[model samples]
Structures are given as C-alpha cells and as structure tokens.
Target chain A: MTQDSRTNSIVINGLNDSAFKVRLNRNLEIIQSVLANPTTVIGLVIVILMLMMALLAPVITEPNMPDPYQMPRDWQAARSAPLTPGHVLGTTNRGGDVYYGVVWGARTSLKLSLIVVCLTVVLGVTIGSIAGIVGGKVDEVLMRIVDVFLSIPELIFALAIAAILGPSFTNIILALVVVFWVKYARIMRAQVIRIKQRDYVDAARIMGDSKIQIYLKDILPNSFSPVMVQATLDMGNIVLVGATLSFIGLSEAGIAEWGVLVSEGQAGISAGRWWASTFPGLMVFLWALAFNLVGDGLRDVLDPRTETKR
Target chain B: MSSADKTILSVKNVKKHFPIKEGVFQKVVGQVHAVDGVNFDIKEGETVGLVGESGCGKTTIGRCVAGLEALTEGNIYFDLPSDKIALLEDSEKQDDKKVSAEQIEEIGNSYDIGKIEGDLFNHYRRNCQMVFQDSFASLSPRQLVSDIVSRPLRVHNVCPENEVIPRTINLLEQVGLGAQHLYRFPHQFSGGQRQRISIARALALDPKLIVLDEPTSALDVSVQAQILNLLHDLQKKRGLAYLFITHNLSVIRHMADKIVVMYLGKVVEAGNTEDIFANPQHPYTKALLAASPDLQSEVTSGMAALDGAIPDPARPPQGCSFRTRCPVAQPECGWEVDDVVRRLEHKDSIFNFLKEVDQSDAFNAKFTFETEAAANQLMAAMKSDDIPDAMKKMVSKLNCDAEHVTVSFKPAKTVPLIACGNGSSARCVLVNK
Candidate 1:
C-alpha cells in the first residue's frame, strides 16, 4: 500500500522474471524436441493433408449437385484407367469418379470417428470416475457391467446391435459408440483411481470442493493426457471398424463411406478392372495409416515417460 | 492475552482407527489405531505444533481437524455454541449411533464438524484448510499458478467473477510471488515458490485455522526458513490459528507457542513451548530433546538414542509407551512381559536361545527355552546390570525349571498424564507419584 513497499515488490518481481524466462525457455526446448522427431514430422504432414481434405470437403464438391455422395456415371468414359482426365485415378464399373469418392469420403470418415471418440470419452470418463471415486457397492455394480460388456467381442457386439437397429447412419454410429465406450470407461476408471489419491485431490476436498467438483476439476484434468492419447489411438481403430462394418453390409448402402466405395467396386476387380476397387481400398488404408502415425506421434509427445526417456 | 483470543478449534479425545481387512471375505480383522484418544486445541492467532515421529499419527490428527478424515470417536468442535456442545455431550452419552439426523441438524447451530450435515459441514470445510507436507504433490500439475491460488476464492465465491485473477495476483504477491509467475504450471517454480503458492491458496479463504502438515519437511533448510518467516509475517498480518505439524523439534521451538509431543498415536507431553522445553517431565520428551543434537548443547554431550522403533499402534505397550526405551524407567512404570521381550530383542545371544512363549496377558509370560542353562541366563541377566534395578524389583515371580522359565511383574496401574506445573502435564508415573 505504501510507495516504498510498492518499489520493494517491483524489485522482487524483477528478480523472479529472469527465472520465469528460463522456465519458458525449457518448455520451448521440450516442444522443439518433440518436433525434431522424424516420425512426428511425417505424421504431422499426413495428418495435415487429411485434416485439410476433411475441412475443405464441402468446398471441393459441388453443393447444388444432386447425389454429391458419388459422381454421376459417364458411360462414354467408363473403365478409364489411372491418370484419366476429369475422372482421375480411373472410373469404376458403375462409371462413378474414383477421385470424388476418395475426396468426400474423408469428411464422412473424420466426422464419424470424431463423434464416436467424443461420445465414448464423455460416457466412459463420467462412469469410470464415478465408479473409482465412490469405491463401494456402486463401484462393484458399475464395474461388473463394464466387465460384462468388455467380455463380449467388439465386432460381434457391434454387428448384433447394428443388425437389430437396421441399416442407417445413426444406427451405425450408435452401434460403434456402444462397443467403444467401454474402453474409455475402463481407462478412465483406472486413471481416476490413481489420481484421486494424489495430494492435490485431497487438498481440493479440504478446500470444500464438492465430490462432483473434485472429480470434474481436480481428478479429471490430471487424467486428461492419458485419455487424450487413448482417444487419438482409438480414432484410427474406430474408423477401421466403421469401414469393416460397412464392407460387411452392416452400414447404409448409399453413402460416401470408403468401405462402401470399396464394396461397390468389388465386382469389377475380378474382371481385370482393378482400378474400381484398388483405388478405394488404397484410400481406406492410407486414411487409417495417417491417423495411426499421428496418434503415435502424439503419444510420444504427451506421455511423460517418453519425455523423460529422452 | 485478553478474552478476545478465542479458541478457533478444540479437539477432544479424537480417535481414528483404520480397518485392516484380510481374506476372501474382506472381513474386518483389526484396526490401526492411527490417532488413539488425542486431544489438543488451537487458539486464534496462535501456533500449536504437533511434534512426533512419522507413525505417531500427527498427520492423521491434522487430517481429522481439516475435515479430510472422519473421526472414529470423540469430537472436534469448531466455535460451537454451549447448548450445542451440551446436546453433543448428551448424544455422546446416550449411544452416538442412535443420535438422529434431526438432532445433528439442530446442533448444526455450531459445528460438531464430523456429524453436522449439508451447509454446516461445507462451512467448516471452507473455514479450515490444509497445507500438505509435499508441495509438489499438493499443487495440481495441470493447473497454472494463478488458477491454483484462485481455486479457493472461486470455490468459496469470495470475490466477483471478473476479479478472480486480480485477487489471485494479490494473494500471490502477499506470499512474495507475483504476476510473472501466474501462468506457469507448478513444476516451473522452485520448491520454495511452490510452497509459497500453497500458502497463498490456504490464505485465500481467510480461514480461521490452517492445518499446516509439515509444510517445510520437503524443503531445503534456507527455503524452510524463508517459508517459516513468510508464515510468521502472514500470521501477524491476519490473525490465523495454525496447527503446525512437524517432527523437527527445533523448527517447533522456533515457530510454535504450544507443543504437543506424541508417541505411538498418543500425546506423551504437552505444554507452553518455553515451559516444556525448560523442564520436560516426560522421559520420552527428554530422550527426544537429547536425541536431536543442538548447537547450543555442549559438544561433549553425547546424543541419547532411544533403544528401538515405535511400538506397533495396533497393540501399543500397555503402559507408558516409552518405558521399554525410557532411560529412567522405574518399578511403577507398568512393566509388562512385552518389556522383557523388547529388552531381549537387541541382545541377539539372549533372544536366539528362547523359542516359544505362553502368555496370559501383556504383564506375564512363560518362556520355553532350549535348555535350563539358557533359562537361567535370562534370570542372571535380569539381576545383573544388563537390566534396570527398578525392573528387577518389579519381578515378583521368576521360576526356572529344566527348560522353562515363567516371569511376571507386579501389576502396576497404567500411567496417566499428571499435572507437573503451570499448564504443563506429562504421562509419567514419577510425576504422578
């Protein structure tokens, strides 16, 4: 409150500012180390390409054109092989442009995986934290339910649910979500059990934080890095599963999905018109691979063990 | 001291027994008596140091006071009304479990914190906070410095929405940290600075009592001094009652006005800091002071070390818990059969000869050794200088046959705390005698 005290405080702040700068520099160094890894760089490039494709999907396609899911058939240009103008990479037996299917499929694929991952994380984390923190009859009941769901093989469960719900985009998402949320829940429960014992959580309780507040604010945030890594890795797996389901005819038939695209061209593959299915199949593989690489990269950066190992 | 100095927290006969369960059924087998019948109080604007060895339950008592752990029995009254205290006393007398929820709610006029429900509990929680031993673990790594300090303010709704950051900055400055350190996470700061942040957070609620659980144990010596000074300055600035828990006597000597020395979950001695240090009637207190080397003490004064570890809290010695290692233990110190085993524990040759024991109680036991000579060896040692004369006098029965020896001490009363001087007490038979 006095001028002398104000000046004294300023001097103290000045002394600490240099130390603060050193810490900032160290943080930047860690970021620099992460970026320096070649795997992370390659992963970054592929991730950027896919992200751009997904983000620019609508602009790249003709919005007013009916049936934007697939290109219109061109009978005159049918069976055109790789590098053919206007229908680059080739034309399918159905005469739809392979490039169009690949481009728009990115949007559908990204959106589906993101929605599924988000739903699984929210549902799983909420349930898992509650089970772990409460730790009694409630924990026993919830965890046993998780165990039952976990015991059922993921694909089998997804197939049964999708079949019962019948084929639709929403139904497919619902099935995938039901199958995937268990993974997040189990991971989150384990994380919550560990973090809840941490001193900071105890401090929060002593600070008068309600049980809900402690879980949401204190325990959940500390457990985020692991959940984020798991989410990233699962995004790729979910997309692959979505594609597999569609290929097996568990998905809506008329969709811009990569798995559907491949199924449509499967008949042409035996007739020596390999471009029909090969290009679409290749797109699916590349999409999964790109996400996997990015996920791996993120893991290396986010995991404290990995950072310490370096 | 005037009547204005009110008691901020009063803990009476607090006990916390953690259930130790085993087997497939997970049935409760035993309980670790973590804080067994401890009592102390913190007056407003004063510091009371809870000094003890690691397993002595100082931290547990702190947690109980901070409302982090429920008391298994007894009461922790926080500025409770006289009528409410009377009601609690009635409930305590009548069968504590049968005390209805309505009674608890009615007694919520003032807090019997462990029993009070809803808003009363939250009020006690907000008014009493804890600063833990480990600063690194106590501050969440994911949170920035500003957010960590501002958390209490935001949780308690101490200020308006827009002023949270500014208030946090002000709190930080009071602890000698400032705007430059705001956005950085806990790991970025030095140990001292992080502890400062913890102090700042504790101060945020304008609490009446702060349970400082070894706030300096994890810090370097110089940093500890700085933090202690900061704490002192803050205490002076705002009339805050502190229950400062630590194992370091010198630190307690410097910071605390009243000192409570605990051993095996029980307070052995407690009094005003100056009086207790000047004349520690409890032998345990004397051993502790002598064990901790002080520069002020003569260099030729050899440190007096206690003989063994703290007894198991699950079954603490049935007498003065310190008697087995007490240098001045006497006949009336409640010598028991457990003491003979404890005495033989350090002498390898004597302990290795004996195998089995048939005991009726802690005070008597029949030992079956390998041969008669080994049994006679213990008897001879008991009379020799190896054992104390006072213990030898308490040996009312000692019989040795071909291979077994039965021994028993004259049953003595369990030592209780006796008043020694003005406001000073000790759990020693000598003081009582």
Candidate 2:
C-alpha cells in the first residue's frame, strides 16, 4: 500500500529469480537514493509544505476579504504590533493583516514559480530536443539562437518583458519562460545530442522509425531526465526571478505577490514593523533552497554513473 | 516459390563514399570510400553473413541495403527480381531521366517495398528492421519495456490500444520475457535481457528482413551464443531473411547462409557459404580467414596472421588495393612509386627523414632527399630483394635521377569480383575467370 513497502518487496523479490523485478529495483533505487540525501529530503519537504500552504490557504486562514481593485486595508487596524493573538503576525501599516499577507504571498509566489517552471521546461525541452536530435544545419541555426538567448541576463530580461507585457500573472509567467527556457533547451539539447548518438537511437532507426517519430519516441524519453532536474531547480529560480520583478514595482496592480509584500513591509520597517517583509522573504529562501537541494539529489539518482554506489 | 525467384534483397554494386578533408579551407579532397561497389543477395528465409575488418564497410553496406543511407552510386533493390532489375537497367540506358517513374514502379510493384507516401513508407518500414550493438545504450532509459516494444505496433496501428499490451506480452514471451516485464524499464534488464527486448521490438512488426548489425558483439560470448541460437530458431519460425553483418568470422560461419567477404569498400569474394569457407579465393578473404580465431579447429596450421591492419579506405592501394600487403602480389598488381616510397619510408630512415614530399602521381612522388646517399638509398630500397619478391615483381620502371627521386611503378587494374573457373566468384588474380 505504501511506497516504502512496495520498494522493499521489489528489492526482496529481485534477489531470487532476478528478472524484470531487477529492473524495477534499479529504478526504485534511483528514486530512493535521490530522496535519501539530507539536503534533498529537506528541500522536498519544504517544497511540499509550501505547495500545500498555497493550495489550502483558503481553508487554513480567515482573512477579511478586500476588494481586488482597492488596497487591502481596513485603515482602522493599521500599523498594529506583532502578537495581537487573533491577528497572530500582527497588522500591516495599511491595516491589512501581515500573517494573511504571507499566506496569500506563499500561494502567489508558488503558483507563479510552478507555472513558469512548467512552461520553461516544455519550451526548453522542445527547442533543445530539436537542436540536439536533428543535427546539421537545423541544429547549427537553433544552437546559435539558444546562445543568444543564454547570453542575455535572465532576471533583467524577465523584468523588461514583464514590464512591457504589463504584469498580469500570465505575463510574468510568460516573461519567466521567455527568459529562462534557454537553459533547459541548452541542457536538454546537449542530453539529446548525446542520447541521439546512442545505440538505442540507432536501434530505433534500424527499426524503421521516421525522423520525427525517432525524436518524439526515442530521443524525447531519454531527454526528460535532465529537463526534469532542470525543471525542479528552475522552480526555485522562477520564484526568485518573480519576486525580484515584483520587488521592483513591476508587479500586476493589487496582486499580493511576495516581492510586493516585501516592498510594502519596507515602507513600514522604519516604524518597527518587521513582519511585513521577513515572512515573505523567508518563504522565498525556503522554496529556493528546497529546489537546489532537490536538484542535487536528483542528479545523483538520475545519472547512470552513480548506480555503482547504489 | 522457386529458389531462383526467392531472393528477398539484392544489393547491386552499391557505393557510398564520405568526403575527407586534409589541410585548410576544406577543399574537395579525398573520399573515404565507406561502401565501394559491394554486391550481395539474401534469398527468402536465408541469413547472409557479411564479414570483414573494422573499416571494411560491412555495416555501411548493411545500412545501405536497409535504406538507412542514400548511396552515392549504384542502388539497393530490396525484394526485387534480379531479372526485373536488369530489365529496368536496360530501359534506364535508353532514357536518361527514365529511372524515377518505371524503375521505382518496378521495384514497388514487383517486391512491394511500398509507395513513398505515408502508409506506403510505413508498410515498407514494417517489413524491415534492425538490431544494434550496444544493449546498454540502445533501449531508452525512460521507457518501460512495454512502451518500447509496443511503440511500433501503436505507430503502425497494427493493433488496437488495448490489444497492444497483450501483443507486447506475446512478443516478450517469444523473446523469453513475460508478463512481469510489461512495466519494467530497460535499465532493469541485464545486457542479455536488454538485447532480447531490442529483438522483441524488432520482431514486433513481423518483418521479412532484420538487419542484425553486430547483434551480439557487445555481449559476453555465452550470451552471444544464446542470442545467436535464439535468432536461428526465430528465423526458422518466422521464415525471415537476415543481413547478418559482423566482423567475427565464427559467427558468420554459424549463422550466415551465404557469406560476403568485403575489403575496404569492395566485395572481395562472395558465393554460397559452403564454397567460401571451403575455398576462399580472394587474398584478403584468405588473410581474413587465416587471422580469424576458429574454435573448432586449432591455430598455427596453414592459418595466417594478417601482416598489418587494413589500409585507409581514403587512400587505398591503387592496383589490387591489397598489393601493399599481398604476399602473392604480381607484376601487374599495380605497384607504383608510392609503394617504393612506402618501402623506403619503412626500411630506409633516410626516406623517412624527408621534411617534405612533392607528388607527381600515386606511383611517382618527388622526395626532397637530405643527401645523395639517402636518395640513392631510396632508389636502392626500391630495387631490393628484401621487399616481398611478388611486390618487387610489380615494378615497371625506376628512376633516381633527381635529389627528389622519382620511381615509376606498374599500374595494375582494380580486381572486381568475377566468376572464377569454378562455379563460385572471387576477386583475386590467382584464379582465372
């Protein structure tokens, strides 16, 4: 019923007849080995908790709903101190609750990162796969474009695009994908280049697959690992990138973004209200740290070379 | 149904030459003749062995036959009647632009290689497949065995989606795997097991011709034996035609119905496997057999150790191509100034000491000798009895008139595979055609 026992049974079963169960054990070992690393474990837990908070923020918190078009403050409970008990994290200078702002901020930042990472992975995998698999002139042309994309500073470019696109959540995500996807494509393209040259790809060709089918069926599956690792790491990066964009006042009008919360908290910092920025800022660090930890764990687990230790 | 009418694939004078550049600016340079003028045929329900050294172009010819590579010259006619291809050729002579319509139509209509359109290409593709060398690298790491094997069936719409798993199970069973393998990934399988999975995937289409390119070279010997036996049994059951390409002579002996001996880019010898092994005609084929390890027989009898590695296909020996190493090279095996220079480069250090080379032809190169003695040494080496008596016999003219010595050697013709005095064909001068 549980994944742990399932893994145990596979390991045990694998020792006897030593057939397909052996293969299952191999994949299980990779998953376990990745999850076993302390940093990865910690990162995964952090990411999981952040995602849960984002999803269940409505159920766990009772924030007084303010009009979306208007500022989020009662204007009466403004600039209240911490440990107000029912107001737990206290109130913002705008009379909006600081704890509630953080809960909403976690949801926003997490959503933006998740959306941006997915888009980047998809786009990166697509372009990278094409460049790597279909070698020669097409590859030459695509790799040069990737080089140009990679040459530009991702955060600054993301800010510029977000500013021009006028800062809806969609626009920020689009900007993140536009700026960050080149890395995935570059990683994926290299993986694909290596994979496409592999004997399995040759076997696929000998099996009489068209060039397109070979890319989709043969090259695509193998290409997913590096991209998956990149995607998980990019989730952390998108959060940092997104927060920076919001921090610079380029966020959508009235959105409760983490960087926006940090700026609002900044205005109140002089008056001794620190909760405004600290919680939102801490959320960003925790999520980003979690992604890097998970990324390192995934590299060892997914890489074929590391199997010897396992 | 007749033996004469049953050839499944006919490779007629296939040639594939890859360009090689030496200096700068990437000028039009020498061509590394990968598959040069190779010819063979696989009859229905027969496995043909194509054996040679590493750069002998056996795999290149196989790739050409499988339609994986476009031939620079000549054509691979799969499942076409030799008589029909000959007739199409005669027609091609009359009309220069005649090849596209009638020739392709003849191949398509006769053997049904299928049309060039969507379903047609799929049909032809389904009929032919390949098994690669490296088991660890061939199967996709991300895919489960089920997905890898069942992919062809799904792509061709050979079976309904639900039936795909069942069909895949059937294929797996045929290859010694079972239901438990359905969800397992390739990494879970052993080297032998992964190769089985690759074979099962190849067999998914029920193909007529499976291009087995070193199917067992990467596996352990025992595993290779098992795979070879498996292939033999499967061939019997499916009545499949096989292009069994390998560098191992013993494998070809066991598995190949007919054997083709290739050297550089040419078929040096070809005929029934029985005739080839019993009486190898080409000198290269003889050297290859002598060098190959034979398990059933002990070594050091009449067996040969090849004098040296194969010459670069880019700059093959001009006359017999094997003249450089041919123990039985003749006065007309095409020895040239290069051969004399080649001899001096090895035996005379003075020729080796030349800082630069100026060439007049392959047989005549002007060497800038540092001293008169070295130039005379280069001239003296050309006329030496120390060189193989046969190669020395190939010298037509020798001139050491320059500090840059020039030697004009005999120009021998390329030895094409022709029918010998016996029923078999050989590409050697030893046997009269």
* lDDT against true structure, model 2: 0.76
Please, what is the TM-score per model?
Answer: 0.81, 0.83
Candidate 1, residue B199: how far the Cα is off, in Å: 1.7
Candidate 1 clashes between residue pairs 3 or more apart in a chain or in different chains: none
Docking class for model 1 is: acceptable
Clashing pairs in 2: A23-B188, A200-B138, B334-B412, B337-B363
Clashes of each: 0, 4
Tens-digit per-residue lDDT, B1-433, candidate 2 = 1144477777766789998755434466889989878777778888888888888898887777666677888756566667776765665585566456666565655454322445555666788888888777777776778778988888788976646666787999999988777777676678899899999999999998898989999999999999999999898888888899999888898998788888888887888777777777777777777777663253323745677667778887776777677777777677766566555555647555575677777765667777777778767766677566777666556567656676555666787667975556877777673
- Residue A240 of model 2 has an lDDT of 90
Task: For candidate 2, write residues A1-310 as lDDT tens digits.
Answer: 4876566456434422454665677768777878778888988898889888888877767644663322366577777777876567767667766677777777887778877787778888888777876766687788788888878888878888989998677788888879988898888878887777887777666656678888877777666776788788888888898888888877864466778778777887886788878888898888889988898789877664553233
lDDT, candidate 1, A166-199, per-residue tens: 9877788999999999888888888888888888
lDDT of 1 at A70: 49
